[model samples]
Target: MALNKKPVKGMKDILPEEMQIRDYAISVIKETYGKFGFTSIETPCAESIANLTSKQGGDNEKLLFKVLKRGEKLDVAGAASEEDVVDFGLRYDLTVPLVRYYSAHSAQLPSPFKALQIGNVWRADNPQRGRYRQFMQCDIDILGEASNLAEIELILATTTTLGKLGFKGFEIRINDRRLLKAMAAYSGFPEEAYDSVFITLDKMDKIGPEGVKTELLENGFGESCVERYLELYQGLEKAEDGVAYLADMLKGVAETSVTDNLREIIDSVQATKTAGFEMVFDATLVRGMSYYTGTIFEIAIPEFGGSCGGGGRYDAMVGKFTGKEVPACGFSIGFERIIMLLLENGFQIPDRPKKIACLVEKGVEGQALCDVIAKAQAMRETGSQVLVVRMNKNKKFQKEQLMAEGYAEFEEFYKEGLRN
Candidate 1:
C-alpha cells in the first residue's frame, strides 16, 4: 500500500484562505499588544519532561506529546520507567516555556518584563470544534510586577486586541484563586482540600450548581460544607455587586487585601477600557491551572458559546525555575478559536492593499514576460499585491479561481498586446 498523504489525526493542513486570516490575526495581535509595552519573545516547542510534568500545568501535563530519547540514549529495554526513556515533550501551552525563558534570561532582561509570545503547542488531545491536538497560542505576560496593575494592563490589552479584531460585547469572566479558596474556607472546607473542591466547582457551567453540590458530596466532602459553599453562589446570583458580597462574607475567613486588589483591577479596567466588553465578577471561574496562585480569568464570547482564551497570575511558576518567587501574571488569547470565529463570521481584514492578477498568455515571448514581471514588481513596491501567472486554456475559470482568492483587478497579456 502507498504511504498515507494526509496529516496525522487531530492535526490539520491550513489552506491559503485560512492562512490569510491567521496571518492577519497575528499582525493585529502583535500590533495591539506592542502598544501596551509587551515585547515579542520565542521559546522552543519542546521542553524537558521534568519541567513539563512538574504538576503546575493541571490536566495539560497528562496530555503532553512526549519526546523519547534518541540514538544511544534510547535504551527502551533497559529503562525502568517512562522518564528513563522519554526526556522531553512538546509544550502544551506557552506559560511554562515562558517562565523558563524568563528565569534563564532575567539577568539581562528588564524588571517586570512584559512578554508577548505566539507559537504552536501540541497536546495529545481528542480534537473538537475550535480545539485540536496541535494549535497556535498567543500569550502576553508580565513578570516581576507584584501588584494588580499587571492584571489591569493584561485585561485591557487583550480586550483592546479583540476589539481591534472586530469582537464586541464579549465577557471577560474574572475571578481570584485566592477568593475561591477563601470561599471554601468560609464554608468550612479544610485548607488542603481547596484544590479538590475548586476542581468540582470549575464544572459549574457544564453541570450547574446542583451538579457541583452532588459531586462534592459524592467525593466524600461534608454535606454542611457543600451546602454552605453552594449557598454562596445562590446569594451571588441575587446580589448586584458579587465582589462586595464576597468581601463582606469572607472578611474574617480570608485576607482583606485579596478582595481589595481584585476590586481595584476590576475598577481600573472598567474605568479606562477602550474595548466593547464586560468585566464580570464570576465566582464560578476556576481556571484549571494548578500554578495560578492569585487572580484567574477566561474569555467568553457569546458568538462562540465557549471560552476564547484565558490566563492568570502564576506567581509560583517562575520560582520553580529560579528558586526565588517572582510576581507574574499573564493572559492568552485562544488564537485558533478566535480565527475560527472570525472565519465563521466572514471577517474581512481591514485596509488590505489592492490585489491585482497579471495573467500572461502561454504564447507570450520572453521580452513580454519580462515586461509583465517588471510591471508587477513596480506595483509591489508601490504597495499593491500583484500575482503574475501563465494564462490557462480556460481563462474564465482561471480568473474565477483567482477572484475567490481575493484578486480583484486583472490584466491579461496577449501575444500581440495587453487586455484589462
Candidate 2:
C-alpha cells in the first residue's frame, strides 16, 4: 500500500502544463532585461539566518520561514522546537541575498552593475487570494550608484518587460519616502505620525478618499497633514495617465529633491524611449518595505487587485554586508503572481518552441527506440523542452492513443517503420 504524500501548506507545485506560461513570462523578462545590459546571476536558495533578517529591518521580519538545524541531536531538538532550531532558511526575497553577493563580488564588477535574476523565494504568510507562501521573483538591480538614473532605468526595464508579458492599462507608481516623511512632519504629526502614517497611506486606494482621511485622523495625524496627503492622492487619480500624472505631481505635491528626481526620471524615460510604456508619479504612495532610502515604486495592473511587483533604493544594503555604506536600488516582479494573473486573464502564450514531441513504445525494437531518443535530444540541444516517454506502453494501440499526448506535431517513425 502506498502512503499518503502531499506538498506542505504554503508551498505548491509547478505542473507541466503550467510551465508553458511560466517559461513564456521568464523569456520575456530575460530578453527585455538583457536588452538593458542586465546579466543573469543566481544565489543559493539557503542563506544564513542572520543575513535575511538584518536587511529587511523590522517591518518584513514576520514572513521569514526558518530551517531547523541538523545533527545527531537533531531528532530530539528538531521535533520539539521546530521553529527555533532552524538556523538557515529559504530566502524571502532575492534582493537581500543579492546584496550579500554583490558586496562580495563588487570589486570584480563595473559601476552601476545591473543583475537580472529568475528564481524562487519562500515566504511563510497566511494563504489568501493572489497570495502564496512561495513564489518566484524576476528582479533587476543596479548596484554602486546613487544617481536617480537607476530608478529611471528600472522603470524602463520593468515597463518593457511587462509589455512583453502582455500587460496593458498598467501604471508604474513612483514615490519618494523622504517626501512621505516630510509630509508627516509638516502636518505636525511628527513622531507619532510614523506609527501608522504609511500604513494608512498604503490603503488610500482601497479605503477610498474619505476612509483614508478618517483613518489618518484616527492615527493622530493633524488636519493639515491629512488634508495634504488626501489632496496628493486625489491629484494623482486625476492626472490623466502616468506621464501626465508625473507632470502634475511634480508641480503639485513633490517637494525637495524628490521633485527633481521625478522630473529627471520623466526626461530619461522619454529620451530612452521604450515603446508602450507609462509612468505615474504618485505622491500618496508609501511602500511596505522599511529599507527604502530614496525613490520607491510599485507596479499596478488593473487585472491584479494589487501590485504585481515593487522595490526601491536602499543605498545602504551592501553596507549591512561589508559595513561600508553602498548605494543600491532594485525592483522585482512577483513571478508567480504575474503568471497567475496572465493565466487568469487568458492571455495568449507563445507556442512551444520545438514542435516535435515523441512517445516511445515499450518493448519496441532497440535500434528504433534509440533513434527516436537521439532525435529528441538533438532538438533539445537547440533549446527545446524534451520530455522522454518513460512509462510502459502497449505498442499495438500506442500511436492512435498518442494523438492527445502532443505527439501529433512530431514526424512519426515507429519501430515497425524501421523494421521495413
Task: Give each model a TM-score.
Answer: 0.98, 0.82
**Best model per lDDT:** 1
Q: What does candidate 2's lDDT look like per residue over 110-223, in tens digits?
A: 887999888888888888766788777789999977888788888888888887777777878787777777656545566655747778777767887898889878866678
In candidate 1, what are the lDDT values of residues 32-128, reduced to their tens digit? Answer: 9999999999999999999999999999998999999999999999999997899999999999999999999999999989999999999999899
RMSD of each: 1.3, 4.3
In order, the Cα lDDT scores of the candidates are 0.93, 0.75
Which regions of candidate 2 are displaced past 4 Å? 55-58, 72-86, 222-255, 347-351, 357-363, 367-405, 410-420
- Assess candidate 1 and give its TM-score to the true structure: 0.98
Single out the weakest 10-residue window by summed lDDT for candidate 2.
Answer: 245-254
Q: Single out the weakest 10-residue window by summed lDDT for candidate 1.
A: 411-420
